[model samples]
Target: MLNSNLLRKLDMQDLMVFIAVYQQSSVTGVSEALFVSQSTVSYCLKKLRTSFEDDLFINTRTGMRPTHKACTMYAHVLKILESINLCHAGPATFDPTRQAVTFNICAPEYFEHLILPRLLKNFDFADLPVIVNMHKLETDIPADELRDGSLDLVICFGPNFHRSHPDFKSQVLVEDDLVCVFDKRATPLEPRFSLQAFVERRHVFPTPWTSTTNMVDGWLARQAYKRQIVARANSYSAALKMITGTDFILTLPRRIQKLLAKDTIFNHCEAPNGLPGFTLNMQWSQNSDPDSANTWLRDQVLKACAEQGLS
Candidate 1:
């Protein structure tokens, strides 16, 4: 067992430093995040190392990585910090028009394009003096960060949401069907887009999922067919651009077609039969659900969806 005396010497600040270093993997990052000097973070780590009797983090080429012991200790340390935060967090009485607050939300890039404007407009209309931050989301949910309150909300595809995580609650925001965009001038128009024609065309695949594969590919594989993916684009419009004036095709959410239809060269067709549509959902941890600030922030997004007629 660790020496009880040394453990008693460890303070909340030291634990906070430890958690920050673990998450960021850089002393400089922890220093900046915690508003402390690098030396101060180093000093806290030194004290923590003495108490734990282990080098919790080790420097490597990429960054400082947590040791096995440190990895195991992370959950316990996080619980301690969370419990402390709960003790100090009394009833939240907030006024959006008067109180200054910050809301951090993570979602795919298209959400920004489609919903952010309306959300911002609503915020401005109310004269709410608050900061809004939108972070680009990855395929994997940042469950730990959400549970610990670092991430206020997450918006992800329905299939990608971690439904098994009991601590999270989710609501479907929108359901979108896929539409294929290509240069009508170059490719012959068929009333029906056959699966064979779809698999035969060169494709500019949209990504941040996988360079070579995605859900569509998985479906094609199950049917013993696959598309020719020639290039990868991070954005749907970029993918459409690559396929413009050529036989290459880009399949993306139908919502984007109207926005890009002004480009007379491009044409849209319904995705091939048997392909499934997708849904986007808004998710939040139970820890944040009851917070007045988070509730108001969610209201803005819902209003934005209503503006888009996404009921």
Candidate 2:
């Protein structure tokens, strides 16, 4: 039971008014930013209130305060407004030789280390303005940033994260099996590792921030097995450094092992339990600017994965 006519009446201008007011928390601030009279901004607010059938903002001693309803509505409204802007702006004349853009990615540093070097070598972003910001991937609320437009894309371990968000699209870029890495010189036994042998050895595991553990831990729980984690670290790099020249073994992605093959200190060890391989996905929100630039960026990521023999 939705009123199509009522929804159609709501436009981008009204959304802009709402966003400006929400950010600045005052009609005067919005007026200053939009270069309009205070009355004009107030008028737009009134229209939005009527459209939403709620008092979206309240006059306070300090400035203006948003109602709980307004706070919740702002996120969706902002996303919709951004999508509309992208659609109208159309594709940019993306000249990598001179164009400038900032791309934000949410992923682990290990992922960046494996893919960024070769990826950057192919693109000439010297004259063109470019900025790449890497964000740590969170286990909880995977696609929240992408939906809110804070993140352009997410490189996550699996498809489970995007199943609920139908507006997002994903492509599997690489499949990686889990492998144990140990120093070749420190390894005492044969090349093959048994489940008993794995459990008997001291292991290095990336510690979860809270009670919630990682996928490997979950897999271990299913088998009714747990490792005696002698060393814990927040990142794979830290874990790798900790295990080098030590007797501790670390579970790592095969792609990472392949990338680090040149390093004489590390060698792959067999996992007898046959841990499940994970798929690395390249995901973007449907709300993203469907411009040529966005398309080119996605293509570049895919090409880089293929070049690294990860595809």
Candidate 3:
């Protein structure tokens, strides 16, 4: 249980002081980071201690060390403070043409390959100072990142993860048909995929946890079809690399196929008659802040995709 009064009394300034002290292990370091007097930093520390009913920090030869309780509470405190800061910072009034802002995005590598080139071409980040950090969908928890303010947005397939998190807002950005890719030189007798061919062929698939894989398997099961999954990888870049000059056929979104077309290492074919298309969505967390910068970012993405004639 938490003390609501204590929580209500804390603010971003307090957390900033706490984090600076925690990191540099000294009140002087905190004062420098916050551009405040040492006494002000010391005063904030006292308030934190009184509110939490904990020593929180202790002086040591190393400077100041956090107590075990402070260590345990660090992450939660940091996230809360960040949320407060974002809300208060107001709608990023900085003009996209003249201001600089860093945004962190979590997405599949294939999504990155498909969108990055167009995003850079359409949006002039030179003045905006934009930085994108791409993380593997399979390796990171995007919803958690969005909630904690570490991730500004997520572009991913399926709604499973975001559907349950109250803090997130999601919209279907595009719906793409699944296509099978293989070496163009190695053509099978059938121009279109067949259930028997699907089951018999050596298949390379993005990792089973990927929304595409889950949707494909679910569709196959509905149609009473099952394929031998020969390989599972987290990224299409990895899976496609594996399929080069080989007979392995991989099922992926058409957008991914178009992106890979540049490499000429493999070519794409349509899935057998029964498999269904999947929708890719963009998600962001909701904050009380009046800043509509996040919405602007999402609009920019959609506009970029439309300009490229990619739905």
Residue 22's lDDT in candidate 3: 88
lDDT of 1 by residue, 97-159 (tens): 777788888888667767877888887887878787877777577788888988888888766
**lDDT per residue, candidate 2, 1-311, as tens digits?**
55645566766677888999999998888998988898888888888888788899999998889999999998998898888888898667676666667888887655687776766776654444566677777655367788887887787767453245677788888876778888776675667678778778898986422225666766778889887889888867788888888888888877676665435778777676666777777788887746566677788888888887778
* Per-residue lDDT of 151 in model 1: 86
Checking candidate 3 for backbone clashes, the offending pairs are 91-291, 100-128
User: What lDDT does model 3 reach?
Assistant: 0.75
Error of 2 at 211 (Å): 9.1
Point out where model 3 deviates above 4 Å. Answer: 1-92, 124-126, 139-141, 159-163, 208-213, 262-265
lDDT of 3 by residue, 142-188 (tens): 66778777877888776453245666677776777888888777667
Q: All candidates' lDDT scores?
A: 0.81, 0.75, 0.75
Worst 10 residues of 3 by lDDT: 159-168
Q: List the residue pairs that clash in candidate 2.
A: none
True-vs-predicted CA distance for residue 43, candidate 2, Å: 48
What TM-score should be assigned to candidate 1? 0.67
Off by over 4 Å in 2: 1-93, 125-127, 159-164, 207-211, 261-263
